[model samples]
Each structure stands twice: as C-alpha cells, then as structure tokens.
Target: METDMTKGKPMEIIIRFAIPMFIGNLFQQFYNVVDTIIVGRFVGKEALAAVGSSFAIMTFVTSILIGLSMGASALFSQFFGAKQYEELKKAISTSFIFIFIVSLVLTTITSLFMHQIIHGFQMPMETREYAADYLRFIFAGLIFTGVYNAFSFLLRAVGDSKSPLYFLILSAIINIVLDLVFTVMLNMEVTGVALATFIAQGISAVSCAVYTIKRMNFIKFKRKVILFDKKMFKTVASYSILTAVQQSASSFGMMMVQGLVNTFGATVMAAFATASKIDSFANIPMQDFGNAFSTYVAQNKGAGNIERIREGMRGVSKIIVAFSLGISILVFIFAPQLILIFVKKEAVDVIAVSVYYLRIVCVTYTLLGFLQMFYGFYRGLGEVNVSIILTFVSQVTRVLLAYGLAMTPLGFAGICLAIPIGWFLSDALGVIMYKKIMVEDSV
Candidate 1:
C-alpha cells in the first residue's frame, strides 16, 4: 500500500517503512555473505580472499545503477508527496531508459577490462584467478541488477517497501540453494556462487519490474509517452548521476583499500573481506533507517512541510543511536562466534584477524550512522552534490589512512582503525554542512 509520509507522526511512519526495508537490505547483504561462507568453507581461505576482493570490484560497477535509481527514487517520493502524478509518471519512464543505458556501458567496460581490474588489486596469482572467475559471471548479470534497483527503488519511493522485500526474499532463497548446488555439488568454486547470483538476481529483477508495471497503475503510462520528457530527463540525470558518482567514489575508495589489504597476503585479505562483511551487516540498519529518513524528508519537502522534515531528522537520529549502540555491544561480544560462521575452525589465523578488525570498528557504528543520515538527508532534499562531497571526504580519508598507516608498526591494525576515523571526520563535516544549509533555508 502507498503511504503519504507527510501526514503521520514522523517516527512512527519511518519505523513502519524502515522495518521491511531493513529486512530486505539484510537479505540483499545475505547474498554476499552466503557466498563468502560457502566459498570460504567449501573452497578454502584463498577463495574467501578472492570473493572478498571481488566485492569491491562488483560494488564499483553495480553502484552506478544503484546510485542512479536511489537518486531517482527521492524525486519519485517528492513528486508523489506533492501529488504531481503526471510528472512522476514521466520521470519514471525517463529514469528507466537512462539507467538501462548506463548498465550497458558498465557491463561492456567490466567485460572488456576484467583482467586489468583484477590485476590492479595486487592479489596473489591464485587469488586473482578466483577473483576473475567470480567477477565474470557477476558482470554478466549487471543489467539485471540495474533493472531490479530501478524498480525496487521506485516502489520504495512510493511507500510500497513490502513488495520489493517479497521479491528479494524469493530470489535470495534461490541464490542460497543455487550457491550450495553450484559450489559444493558441482565443485565450481567461485564460478558456482557467481553463477547462482547471476541467475537468482535475474529472476528478482524481471519479476519486480513486471509486477510494478502491470499492477501499479499510478506511475504506469501509455507506451507513447515513455522517455519524451526532456526537462524531466535533466532533473533525473542531475540527481541520478551525482548520486551514482557518490556511490562509485565510495566503492572506488574501497577498491583502493582492497589493494592495500591484498598487500598483506591471503590471510589478512580473507580476514578483512569476512570482517568487512560482518561490519557491513552489523551497520546495515543505519543505512536502511537513513534511507527511510530520506524518503520521509523527501515526501515532506515536496509537501512543503519543512518543519516536518526537521522533526523527522531528529526522530531518525534517536533511532540511529539506539540501533547502533545495541548492535555494537552484541557484535563486540560475539566476534569470534560470528567469524566462525564464515570460515573453518582450523583457520585460526583468519578468525583471529577477523575478530580484531571487528572489535576495532564495531564500536564506531554511531558515527557511521550519523554520517549516513547526513548523506540521505541531502540526497532526499535534491542536494546530491553535498552527498558526493561528503562521500569524497569519507572515502579519501579511508584510502589515504589505510595506505599511510600500512607503513607504520600498526600495519594492518591501522587499516582497520581507518574505517571509524573516516566516519568521524565525515560526521563532523556533515554537521557543519547541514547546519549551514538549514540556516540558509530559514533565511
């Protein structure tokens, strides 16, 4: 069902939207975690290292589409909130066309330059082979990823978060079953998991797009009007392209961090990969809530309820602090048990390093949460350049610190420490930027 977020109590409305979104995001992250676990346990630590390395590469490529769709979704919410039905339909059509073109470009580049991309990571030859195998099938499925996000984000923007979750749940189940069949029984190693993901996501993307177009008539259109709005095209492009750059810059920075982690060999690489996923998993609630907050703010902004947007931000921050603190305690206390889920018990070194990395970063999720909310707030308000600038600050700090600290005695420990520091630095900057923007708005 569609919701008008501009009406309800801000916190109540946000939690309702965020609950399903959080679950869906969890399942989405589950795709990668399941791959890591299956690859790590069945294949070996080297393969785990490879999967870890490939994450950065795939995130970089896929983020272009994800970011674009996200930006467009904000616009969707805004238009819907304002009851600009015609503009919403036209923008939807335009964004779908533009996202499709970008997906093709990414698929082409990733296909052609696959080896060079892996080589840049500086992993061992064995790990590179595994990374290459993993990335090949993943790249083949890039178009499906674009289709899925373009539609799912549209659904969320219109306040129908549950439908996307249903689609992800089914596809994620297929992905898990296929992961087992391909990697274990078929002995396909990294190739099996990648192929599983490729097939599973194709199912979700096609299904979601089909359902949304056929069933949701609000944004649907006659075939003739699709892609005809030149002005809306510029609006969609500004939001989508800037957000895409922000997302891509983030993944690109991680790619650099992956290269640095690779320098420490397979053990550290495997540990970082697994630990980072766990870190990502632990902190995903913040991202989901931030997204919900953005949607809330977007709707209110479109309704010209600036005061409600302010209230929504404050309410969302309280939720963030509560979620971040609780998750931090749990993750810190159970770091080893969590690490064991991904790798074998006999892989003592990998487990130890994973624990260390987690312990270092888990406590700082609050800082991460605030920074993420800042990104979402700006993006929702159509100030996507602010998001890009904030992300640039965060990513640059992370990449530079990882490399700089690598030469010191702290070594890999320094790399782990950089994660939270980057968040803190960005959060500080986010505060100042947000305050300035609010003051200007008041003026």
Candidate 2:
C-alpha cells in the first residue's frame, strides 16, 4: 500500500502512525516484563536475574538482524515513495536472502560462543549457569526472530505498521500464557522463560510472514523477482553496514554496562534488569514516534519534499518533548509501585536503586527523545554513516562513564547516572550532525 505518510498534517500523520507502533512496542516489552514478574514472583530472584543477565547478549545478536531490517525499511520506503514498484519488489527479495544468510551465521556464532560470552560478563556463578541455559535456547530461535523482524520491517516500510502490530499483540499474549504454564506449572525455571519467549516469537514471525506473502500483492515474487538483484543488494549492504555498526556499538556498550552490574552481585543485576523493562516501557512513545518519523522523512525525501520533512520533524519534536515530561513525572511519582511490579519487599533496596536510576534518567528523556528522532531522520535521508558515528561516540562515552563511576565513591548510583549523561551528549551531537549534513544539504 505504501501510501504517502507525508501528505497530511505532520502531527496528525505522526500520531496516526505512532499509535499502532506504540501499542505493538508496548506489547513486545510486555512479553519480557511479564515473564520477569511471573518468574520473580513464582520461580525466584535468581531466576529473574538469570533471565535478565542474558538480555544484553541476546540483544547483541539480535541487533545485527534489527539493523538489517532497518536498512531494508529505509531502502524500501525510498523506492516505494519514488513509485518504483519493480525495484521495490526486487529490494524485498534481496532483503530476505540477505537476512537469512546473516542471521544464520550470527545464530551459529553466538550459539557456539554462548558459554564463553556469559563467562566474559563475569556474573556470579549461580547466575552464569542460568544465563548460559537461557542464551543457548534463545540462540536457537534467532533465525526465526530475524526472519520475522525482516518481514515486519518490510511491512512497515510500505506503510502497513498495523499488520505487524497485530501479530506482536498476539505473540505477547502467547508468551505470557506460556510463561505461566512453563514456569509455574512445569517449574522449568529460566529455561522455561526462554523457551516460552522463543516459541512466541516464532509463532508471531510465521504468522506475519504468511499473512504478508498472501495478502500483500506488491511483495508477491516472480522467478526473476526472486532472483537476487545485484544493484539493490549492494545498496542495501552499504547502508545496512552503517546501521549494523551503530547498533553493534550501542549493544557492545550495554554489554559493558552489564559487566559492571554483574560485579555488584545478583541482587543488583536483578534490579537493573527489572528497571530496564520499565524504562523500555516508558520510552515506547518516543521510540515509536522516532520510527514513524523515519518512514515519514524517508518517503518525503524520496519525493524531494524538503518542507514536509521539516514539518514532520517539528511536529515529532513537540510531541516527544511533551511525552517525555509526562513520563518523567509519572515515573518519579510511581517509582515504588513500578519497582514492586517485578521485585519484592525484601528486595526493596534493589528497587530503591532502580528508582534512583529511573528518576535521574527521566530528566534526560526529552534529550533522548530528540536524539532518537535525529538518528531516524538521518537514516531516512540515507545518511546512515553520520548516525553510526554519533552512536559510537555516545555509547563509547556512556561505557567509559559507567565503568569509571562504578569504581568510585558513587558506586551503583554512579553507574545509573551514566545513562542521562550519555543521552545529553548524544542528543547534542545528533543535532549538530543533522544540521551540518542533512539541513545544510537541503538548504
């Protein structure tokens, strides 16, 4: 369908597009958070910590696939906007092949190194075993996750965000139900949680792919269409590498932070994991808006409509700022209740530490809001390298800050403080880069 997202008023367009994405993204996080709550309440804190510890490693593997999908979305949106139907079809086909190969290789590599990678994080022995079990199962499911995500990206690129959202909601419900059955009834512990998640994601990915292939006429491929197009593959590969680097840098940095959290012991690790789920939920609005803006800007840019792109940016900025402030207030006020959702009264200190992190980081949400949008903005303009550079700068600095601070008088709180500081710096750099390259080029 790939309708022009830039035609309507920027705010209205963004809201329309973002609402579905927000719901979908929230549901996506719900699967994990709900699993944590169920596990913490039913299984135990160590189990929760184990599942949480594997998060960064899982994210590291998944980021490459996500980056590839984003590249496909960006490329498809541009081609769709230009009304190059045949080229768009070819892009879609090439993307599938590219994702399959990359995901297969990544899955194998991560699976083989799973134990070593968890060990490298230097987590407690109790937590490390659980984390290793979880990672092994999750790594097995990476290919399905990658394929599903690629299709989701393909759908979103063509202005059908609603479909992917529908599938995600279904998958979240499945994951929650399965989590209860596996963990509570079967007493499968962390492995149960991981298996439930993998099954849910697999089902969702299959459902989405089937629906897309059957219903979306544009993506239906002929023999020639299915054949990989060299030019389109090259274009996607070039842009995708930049995105891959950006994501790799970010994930690698988080892995570093995870290492620091591991040093603080299992309780701190569990708390960090719980807090991260809440943080992910809170940032949904801004994150979804950034995604919408990326597609919006890409479509408009392809049409050479600079004014529409600018207007979209302005509208997104206002919405993100308002949303950020609202979330900050809510998080500060409900800190205890939010923390209690995944932690317990005995672990109240862990909750307190998490609340401190969230409260402080809340101040920088608006900055992060703008920063994410600008990253999407440049990506839409096919200026992926700029985004990569900014991500590297920000993530590298965040790691350094967290590592150095955690060793000092500030301790865990110092590590928590690193987030807002990173956001501030990243936003400033993103704005500068956008102006220097994209804005200047437009003028």
Candidate 3:
C-alpha cells in the first residue's frame, strides 16, 4: 500500500508511517543487542569487548549502506509523490545495480584488510583475535548488508514500511536462533554471532527483494530500467557521496573515540560497549521518526506541499521531545539493570562506569533526536551538501571533545560529556540551517 503523504493530515500520516519504521528499527537493533548479550553472558567480558570494539569499523561499513539508502529513499519519495512512475522504476533499478557494484568493491577491500583494520583500531591485545574474527565474517557478508538495506530503504521510500518490518521481524528471529545454536550449542563465540547475522540478513534481503519487485507494479524491473542510466546515476551519486562522506566521517570519529576507550582497559571498554547498546535502544524511536519525517518531507516537497512539510516537522518535534523525556527517565532508573542484560556477573567498576555514562547521555536524547530530524528534512529537500557540512562539524566536535575531555580531570566523565555536547551543537546548527534553507526556498 503506497501512501500519498502529501494529501493527508500531516500528523496522522506521519505518525502512522513512522510507527512501522520505529518497530522495524527496534527489531533491527535486536541484531546487535542480542549479539552483545549472548557474547557477554556466555562467552565473557573479553568476548564482549571484542564485539564492542568492532563497533566503529562495522559502523564505517554500515554508514555507507545508510548513506546509499537515504539517497534511494529521498529520490524515490520524490518521484513517487510526483507520480513519475517510469522514472521511479529507473531510479530503483539504478540503485540496486549501483549498490551491487559498490558492495563488491568494499567487500573485497575490507576482507583483505580485516586484521589490519582491527589492529588499527588499537583493539586491546587480549581481545584482538576475537575482534578480527568477527569483523572478517561480517566484512565477507557486506553484500548481504547492502542488499537488505537497499530493499528496505526502497520499500520505505515508496510508503511500504510494513513490508520491511515484516522482513526484519523474521530476520531477528533467525538471528536469535542462530546466535543460540552457534554460541551456546557449538561454542562459536563472536564468530557465531557474526555468521548468524550474515545469514539472517541475507535471507531477508533475497526474500524481500523478490517479494517487493514482484508485488509492487511501480518497483518492477525491466531490462531497460536495470540498464545504467547516466542521469539517474549522477542524481543518486550526488546524494550518496555527500551522505556517505558525512556518515563515514562520523563513524571514523567514533572509531577514534573507541581507540581512546580501548586505552582505558577492557573494563572501561566493556562499559562503553554495553552503554552503547543501551543507548542505541533508547534512541531507536527518535532515529526512526527522523527517517519517517524525511520521507514525508521528500514526498511533499515533490508534490509542492511546503506547508505539509512544515507541519510534519513540527509534529515530529513534539514526538521527539515527549519520547526523549520518557526514555531518559526510564534509562536513568534502570541503567544498572540494563547493563546486567549484557553480562552474567557485572564487574562493579564496569557497572558504575556504564551507569554514569548512560546518565550523562540519556538526558540529552532530545537534542540528538532534533538533530537527526533536521538532517532528515534537509536531505529530503536535496540540500544534502549542507547536511554533510553540519554532520562533519558535529563529528569533529565530538572527536576533539572526546580527546580534550579524556585528558582533563573530567577524564571518562569528559568522554561522556562529549556526546551530549556534540548533540547540542549539531541540533543548534541544524535548526539554523533548516531556517536558512526554508527562507531561501520560500522566496
């Protein structure tokens, strides 16, 4: 069921559209959360640290997929909303073909450098092998990640968020079953988690791709549509490159932060890793809302419904603030309990560190929520270059602050502060940029 967001009550449509996405993202995070929990409880803190340490590198690859997905979503929303079905099919085809090529290149390169990259992260000596083994399998399955993401993004782009949600629900189940079998029954540890994720994602990708193309008349592929269209290629590449740069840069900064955390020893690293999983879960709704808003804005922009876009933005802002407040209070209360989910027996120091980190970061969720929404809106309007600059600024501030604060008496506290500080700065700047872009467009 394709939705014309440009025609409905902005709040109603936005909420309905976002709910499936929010649910899907929650299931999506289950992949990581499950991996961390099993690895921590069954394998040990060292194994947990290895998985945690791989976050930055995994994020680096994951960001490219995100960037490409954003590109497809933005463009497809525009085309579908404008009723340009022919061109829309071409765009969809072009995206799949282009992503396939990029995936092959990235998989080969990353697979070759798997060990070196782990070492480059300055992964602690004790957990280096665990990290390398996990990352190698993940890198080898980059195509699965890329394919699933492309299908998922394209589905959301055309207002079929439900399909993707169904696929993710199934994938989550597959991953969990595999995680238990490999990690518990067979003792594969980190490698088991990686393999489980890869296989599950691959199944979802292929299944969803077949179903979507066969079912959606607008998305059906013809030989002509699948062939490279230079114009379509340029359009998508323009959106993809800047978004990719923005995401990769942010991930690299995180990698730097992880490297710094690695120096603090495995206890702190475990704390950081566990804290991050909790953090991702808390922010899931916000991220999904941001994406939903982006698609909404893109569709309305194509339909020339500027007023609808404004209403959608204001609507999502309220959603962000309300959800953020509720999540912050919950996380503040349950920080310790949440940490225990990852480890069977909590190390006192790791629990204390993780709780403190969560307390500092949770309250600032609203700021991060607003920042993502603004980025989504800007990208939807095809002002991706501006979004790129804003993202770069935010990531740089985070890295610099992470380094500076880690050195100060604030120490790890400073490292914690860097997150909210980055969020505050990014949100502040994003609002300003949004206003500027709107003003110019209105004229």
Candidate 4:
C-alpha cells in the first residue's frame, strides 16, 4: 500500500507536498491581510481596530470547523494509505454532513449571542462596535468556510494539496479586486471588507467542491452509500471535539489578550491587531509544513512505515528551522518598512511597537515550528488528547502570565511576552511528551 508520496526521498517528498500547501496557506493569509491593508488604509484606524478586535472571536467560531476537517484528514490519510478507499469515501461523506450541520448550528448560536460574547470580554465600546460588525458578517460565511475546509482537507489527505492552493490563489485575486471595488471605490468601509472576504471564501469553496466532485471518482456516492454511520460519526466527533477544545481554548486566550489590548486605547489595540495579521502571514510556511507532515505521518503510519515518518519529520524540522531563522532576520531588518505597508504615517509608532513584538516572537519561531509539527504528528497518529492537554496548558499559562504581567511594570510588553513564553513552554512539553510517549512506543 505504498503511496507515491512515501516512495520518494523524504526531503523531496515533504517539499513537493508542502510547497502547494504553503502557497495555498499564503493565499489564505493574503485574503485576510489584503482586507486588513485596505481597511486600515482607507477605512480609518478605528475601522481597522474593529476588524482586528474580531480576530479571536472569528477564530473561536472557525476553530470547530478546522478541527473537524483536521480530524477527517487524519482518518482519511490513514485509510488512504491503507488503501481503504471505501472507508475513505464514507469518512468524507460523513464529514461533509457533520460539518454542515454543526457549522450552521454553531454559526446561528454564535451570531445570536454575539453581543453578549463580545461584551463578556469587557472591551472598549468603540472597539466593541467594530468587532461586532466584523464578526456578524464573518459568522454568516462559516458554512462556506467549513464546507470548503472539509473538502480541502480531503483533497490534501489523498495527495491533492495543489488543487486547493490553485483555487485559493484564484479566490484571493478576486478578493483583492473586490476589496478595491467595495471599499476603495464604493467607500463601504468595514462592511465592504467583510463582504469581500465572504464572497471570496464562497467562491473558493464552490470551486474546490466542484473540482473534487468532478475529478475524484471516490467521492461520487450512491444514496445507500451516503447513509449515516454512527461509528464513523463518533470517531470523527471524538477527535474533532478535542481538537476544537484545544483551538477554542487558545482563541479564548487570544480574546483575553485582545481585551488587554483594548484597555490600552484604540491606537495600541489597532497596532496589536494589525501586527497579529502580519504575524499570521509570516508563520504560514511553517504552518504549511506542519500540515504536510500531518498528512505524511498519517499516511505512512497507516502503511506501517514508522522509519519513513521519522525521516520525513527530520527533514521538515531542518527546513522549518532554516526558514524561521531566515524570515526572522529579514523581518528584523525591515520591521519599519513592513509596518508601513499596512498602516499610516501617523500610526508609525503603533506599527513600530507591533513590529517589535513580531521580532521578539520571531526569535522563537524554530521552537514554535517544532511545537506545531509535533502537534500535527500527534493528531495524525490519533493521539489527540495529548495535543489537547498541551494546548490547554499553553493557553492557560499565557492568559495568566499576560494578565499578571500586564498588571505589573511590563504593561503591553507583558502581553507580548506571553506569546513567546507560552510557545517555549508548550514546545518543551510537546518534545517531552513525544519522546516519552510516541518515540518510546514506536521504538
């Protein structure tokens, strides 16, 4: 049951697979960063701040979808390697059904409670209004995002990461143009930015769905084949719930950090918000590599090729470290220039502060890369509870440290410091767990 991926040199395999994922992820980031740039430049600082404030809340909603898709990927990749085509198709159909129902219900509930949810964080009124508006529109698009993510994950699981990347690239271009049309030409402000994102996501989702259905004969199902299977649903839910909790907890921690940023005034809040978006763009390569490893590990693990999994991981680790160091150095050298790309001259000081925060986090990107890769490895191996526990520990520690330090002489630096420190701690824990549990078991 050796797949084409596992038949290649490890480095060549990882890079070839990861390149498309990296490109697709970068395009996904482009969708968000483009919106941020357009809104920050044209819509005013407050509007930018508003959009930034919704970051955590939006992540909170999307996390469930991401987790479900990730779980499906894990199962599909493993079954794919095992040549269980029928099971893989069943998993895909069941996952699609699960994602649509859960995403719709979650979106409805979250939208209805949006006000209460935002207010619970105790953010400033100005920031809250903007956050609410941005969130309302983004939530409306969850169904599209969830479905697209499920399909994309399925594609990647079966060695088709490039298709999703192509679709995302096309959608991103369309999104950028729409951003100009809606925000710059029409002066629609935050609403326009939100609409642009929604429309782009919808397009990407549709394109991926159509492409997959048309090309992948496995996905074509009869009415009898599509019938619900409780066992499959339970397996998907079990993995997804833990992954979702881990993500939701991390998002909750970010929301707390956002609350702290809000208290500091709109200028600082906007600066932090914008910086986070920039940071997301910077981290995509490592994140994509992590995703590639997850699929690689899942498939190889199913094929009983643990040695190749280790080889793949080792190759990816080197790549991630080198890329992290290179990116960090470049970002440090061009911090101010990069900041100016998204913000105004008047907001230079705020942007500078954000850049400083990014540079600080950049110092630890290698460690963070390890953490991400190991988490992916765990998920691919169906060792999800360990991943969940590690995430909870990291988020809880981050919230406490950020809150306590912010109250001290450190202020926002305390808030910024929380990120790297949490990553270091989480990475250390992941390394220990991997060695003690996974490595030991494999040996």
What TM-score would every model get versus the actual structure? 0.98, 0.97, 0.97, 0.96
**lDDT (tens digit, per residue) of candidate 1 on 137-238:** 999999999999999999999998899999999899999999999999999999999999999999999999999988678665788877657888899988
- Per-model C-alpha lDDT, please? 0.91, 0.83, 0.85, 0.81
By summed lDDT, which 10 consecutive residues of candidate 3 come out lowest?
217-226
The candidates, ranked best first by lDDT, are: 1, 3, 2, 4
Query: What value does the lDDT take at residue 285 in candidate 4?
Result: 82
Better of 2 and 3 by lDDT: 3
- What TM-score does prediction 4 earn? 0.96
TM-score of 3: 0.97
Model 1 worst lDDT window (10 residues): 434-443
Candidate 4 lDDT score at position 323: 90
Off by over 4 Å in 2: none
Which candidate has the top score in TM-score? 1
Question: Candidate 4's residue-wise lDDT over 1-443, tens digit each?
Answer: 11356677977887888898888888888766887799889988887877877776787778888888887788888888888888877787787888889889988998899899888866677767767767778888999889899888888888888888889999899899999999999988888888888999999999999887777775456667876678788887776667777667777788878877888888887788888886787788888888888888888887888888888878988998989888888877887788888898788678767887887777777776877787787888788888887787778888889889999998988888888788888888887887876578873
- Looking at candidate 2, the ten consecutive residues that score lowest on lDDT are 218-227
Collision count for each candidate, in order: 0, 0, 0, 0
Which regions in candidate 1 have their CA more than 4 angstroms from the true location? Answer: none
Candidate 1 overall lDDT versus native: 0.91
